[model samples]
Every structure is written in C-alpha cells, then in structure tokens.
Target: MTEEELRQRVAVAKKFMSALPFCHALDMRIDEAGISEAVMSMPYDPQIVGDPETGVVHGGAVSALMDTCCGFAVNLHPECVSPTATIDLRMDYMRSAKPGERIFAKAHVYKATSTVAFVRAIAYEDDPENPVATATGAFVFSKSRKAGKGKAADKSGAAA
Candidate 1:
C-alpha cells in the first residue's frame, strides 16, 4: 500500500476504535496497524479482575480485546472497503495474565473474500510466544457500506 493509503487506514481504525464505548471503558489503545494486521493493548485494571485473590484479568476482557483487534485487522485489509463485524470468534485460553501487566493482542487477517475475512490473534502480557490466549475469527463486511463511498449501494449499483 502507498504511504497515504496506510495513513488513511490507520486514521480510520483509530477513529473507529475511539467511537466504541466498550473500547473506552476497557482502556484499549492501538499499538500498531498495517495492511492486514493490528496490535492493540489494554492495561490491567482492578475493575476487570476475574479473580479477586489473584488479580488476574477477566477472560471476557481478553476476548473483547482479541475480537476488536481482529475486526481492526479486517478493516485495514485492502480488500475490505467496508466496515466489518465479527461473525465468529473462538478463543483458547493458555494461561492467566500476570497481575498489573498490560495485555496486548496482535491480530492478522490471513484471508479475505468478498464477504468475509479470516483472522488469527494472540493475547499476551509480555512474551507473545507464551500467549495468554489465542483466537481465530471470521468477520463479515457490512452490506450497507458502499464501494468507494460512504453510502449504501443497491445491487444495481445505485445509492440506497
């Protein structure tokens, strides 16, 4: 992608992320974004602790992070000209995240068709090789999002 295109995609991703209320509540931040990949981070917060005794972050928070990261990856894909939503997401927990450590999720779009995008993601506190969880997901593009424009297009290519 050209530098201008990359900048545009990044700006779009950041704007989308900022608009999500849940993202703001979770304190999620964009670390990096590329053509078909995205890295996001969330700080460990006591409010989201699953185990009070251990102070481990909740699985739901991690799941949200992975899902959002996957969607972000799809939005950055060259073939994905429209907004996207998660169709399916499967997460496998490997271990608990360390207390007080910021969690990170890195997601990549492995495949993109006309309707759907396939993504893989890993969540970790420090070492990605030793992930806290791994996720594989599919995202579907919005039918209302028109090609090369912001308005919805009909099957006959007219604006809806």
Candidate 2:
C-alpha cells in the first residue's frame, strides 16, 4: 500500500478503537495498522485485576483486546470494503499476563472471501513468541449496508 493509504488505514483503525466504549474505558491504542493486520495495546490497571493475590489481568479484558485487534484487521483488509461483524471466535489462553505489564495484541486477516474473513490474533506482554493468549475468528462482511464517500451507511441508507 502507498504511504497515504497506510496512514488512512491507521487512522481508521484508531478511530474505530477510540469509538468503542469498552475500548475507550480500557484506554486501548493502536500502535500500527496495515492493509491486513493491526497492533493494539492496553495498559495494565489494578481495577482490571482478576486475581488480587497475583495481580493478573482479567481474562475478559484480554479477550476484548484480542477480539478488537482481530476485528480491526478484518476491517482494514484490502479486499474488505464494507463493515464486518464477528460470526464466531475461539480463544485459547496459554498463561496469565504478568502484573504491571502492558498487554499487546497483534492480529492478521489470513483469508477473506466475499462474505467472510478469517483472522488470527495473539496477546503478549513483552514478547510475541511467548503469548499469553491466542484467538482465531471469522467475521461476516455486511453487504446489507453500503458505505458512501468513505462513511458507513445505515440500514436506511443514511450516514451513520
């Protein structure tokens, strides 16, 4: 992709992440975005600890991060011109994230058809090789609604 296109995709991904209420509350940010992949991160917060004794981050938060990263990848895939909704997602937790560590999620859209997209994601603290969790998911392209002038159109064909 051209530099301008990459910048545009990155902006779109960041805007999407910022708009989500849950993502906003978690203070998620997009570190990088390309035509088929994205990287996002969320800072560790004591309020989101699942195990007070170990200070482990909550599983729910990690899942959300993975899901959002995967979704962003699908949205930014070059072949995808419409919005998509997650049809199914399966996540595997390899281990708990260390306390006081920022969590990073990287996702890639491996395949995309006219109707569906396949994505894989991994969550890590400091190293990508040792992932805390991994996920694979499918998203369906929403053909029912179209986009006009780079803006999403509602069911009634109005800008959303």
Candidate 3:
C-alpha cells in the first residue's frame, strides 16, 4: 500500500481505540500501521503488575497489547467499519517483561474472510526478535451494522 493509505489506516485505528477505557488507562499508543501490519507500544505500569511477589508485568498486559494490535490490523480490511469481536486470543509466553520497561507489539494479518479474521503478533522489549510473548486471535466481524464512520462493533452485521 502507499504511504498515504497506511497513514489513513493508522488514523482509523487510533480513532477506533480512542473510546476504549483500557486503552486510555494503559496509555497505549499506535506507532504505525500498513495494509497488513500494525505496531503498538505500552509501558510497564504499576497498575498492571502481574504478581505481588515479583512485581513483573502481567501476562494479561502482554495479551492486551497483542489484542490491540490484532484488532487494529483487522481494520485494514476494506469491509467498511464493521464491528469486530475477538472470538479467541491465544498467547504464548517466552519470557518476562521487567518493570519500568516498554513492550512493543507487532501484528500481521495472516488471513481474513467474511466470517473469521486471523491475526498473529509478537510482544517484546526494545528488540523485536527476542519475543516476550506471542499471540494468535480469531475475530468474528460485527454481524450487525452500526452508525457513524467510527463506532463500537456490533454483535451482528444488522446495524445496531
């Protein structure tokens, strides 16, 4: 895709997450996006501590980054603004994220069809190859339609 098209995709992803409560609270930021790839970043926060004993980043936080990137990647599809649902999110932990560190997530669309969208991504600190975790997800496009150019996804495509 052209740079202009990628910019528009990134803008759409940002707009889509602007209203997400957790996105705001976590301070998640969209680094960039192309036709099938998206990059997102989130810093370690005290609020997202995984364990009281170790005070390391929680696995859920890593999952959240993956989910955000995957969802954003799906927006690249030319299906209009259809509501999408995360039917499944599977994550594999390869390491741990130290506190005060930042996690960078990169997601790519493996395949997308009318009923199901598939995505895979990896999360790591500073380096992209040294994965802290990896995730795969399947999303069901909003079955119903919704109003507005950017809005919450509907359960069905029938417009809410």
Candidate 4:
C-alpha cells in the first residue's frame, strides 16, 4: 500500500481506539498500524494494579489490550472492509507484567475469507522473546446488510 493509504488506516485505528471507553481508561495508544498488522501500547498505572505488593498489571487489562490489538489488525486487513465482531478469542497469560513498565501488544491477521478473519497477537513489556500473554482469535465481518466499497461478495456475487 502507498504511504498515504497506510497513514489513513493508522489514523482510523487511532480514532477507533480513542472512542473506546475501556481503552481510554487504560491509556491505550496505537503505536503502529498497517494493512495487515497493528501494535498497541498501554502504560503501567496504579489504578489497574491487581497485586498491591507486586504492582503487577491486571489480567483483565492485558486481555483487553490483546483483544483490541487483534481487532485493530483485522480492521486494517485488505479483505476486511466492514466492522467485525469477535467470534472467538482465547488469551493465555504467560507471565505477569512488571511494575512501571509499558506493555505492548503486536498483532497480525494471518488469514481472511469473505466473512471471517484469523488473528494472533503477543503481549510483552520489554523482550519479545518472553511474552506476557498470547492471543488467537477469529472475527467475523458484521452481518449487517449495508454495502460499501470493500465489502466482500459471495460466490454468487451477492454480499455475504
């Protein structure tokens, strides 16, 4: 994709992030976005600490970040035009996030059909080799009938 097109897609992801109340509460930010992948960052906050003694980030927060990151990647997929809803998402918390460290989730959409998209993501604080969490999910295009430019059609050329 052209630089300008990528810029626009990133802008859209940012706008979408800003509109999510939960994301805003966690200070989620889009670090990068392209046609098939996205990276999102969230800074450590005392308000979200689940363990007072350890100051570890909550599992819920990490899961949300992964989910949002994966969704953003799916949103920018070349074949996925309309909004999508998560059909299934499974997140495994590999480790706890360190205190006062920013967490980032990088996600990529690996496959896309007319109606569904598959995505995977890893959440890490500093080293990508040791991830805090990993996620795999599938999102389906909105079943709404509203047609648009990038809408995928069925074999019969009808909107799916």
Candidate with top TM-score is 1
Per-residue lDDT of candidate 3, residues 1-160 (tens digit): 5678667767767887887999888889988777767889998888899887887888988888899888887876555257677889999999888778999999987887657888899998888889999999998753223333344343334575
Badly placed stretches (over 4 Å) of model 2 are: 142-160
* TM-score for candidate 4, residues paired by index: 0.86
* TM-score ranking, best first: 1, 4, 2, 3
Candidate 2 vs candidate 3: the lDDT winner is 2
Overall local distance difference test of candidate 3? 0.80
Off by over 4 Å in 4: 142-154, 157-160
Give per-residue lDDT, candidate 4, residue 92: 91
Tell me the lDDT of model 1 at 73: 90
- For model 3, what is the alpha-carbon lDDT of residue 142? 35
Per-candidate count of clashing residue pairs (backbone under 3 Å): 0, 0, 11, 0
In candidate 2 the C-alpha lDDT for residue 1 amounts to 61
For residue 71, give model 1's deviation from the true position in Å: 0.3
For candidate 3, the C-alpha RMSD (Å) to the true structure equals 6.3
As a TM-score, model 1 comes out at 0.88
Worst 10 residues of 2 by lDDT: 143-152
Off by over 4 Å in 1: 142-160
lDDT ranking from best candidate downward = 1, 2, 4, 3
Which is the leading candidate under lDDT? 1
Candidates 1 and 4, the one with greater TM-score? 1
TM-score of each: 0.88, 0.85, 0.81, 0.86
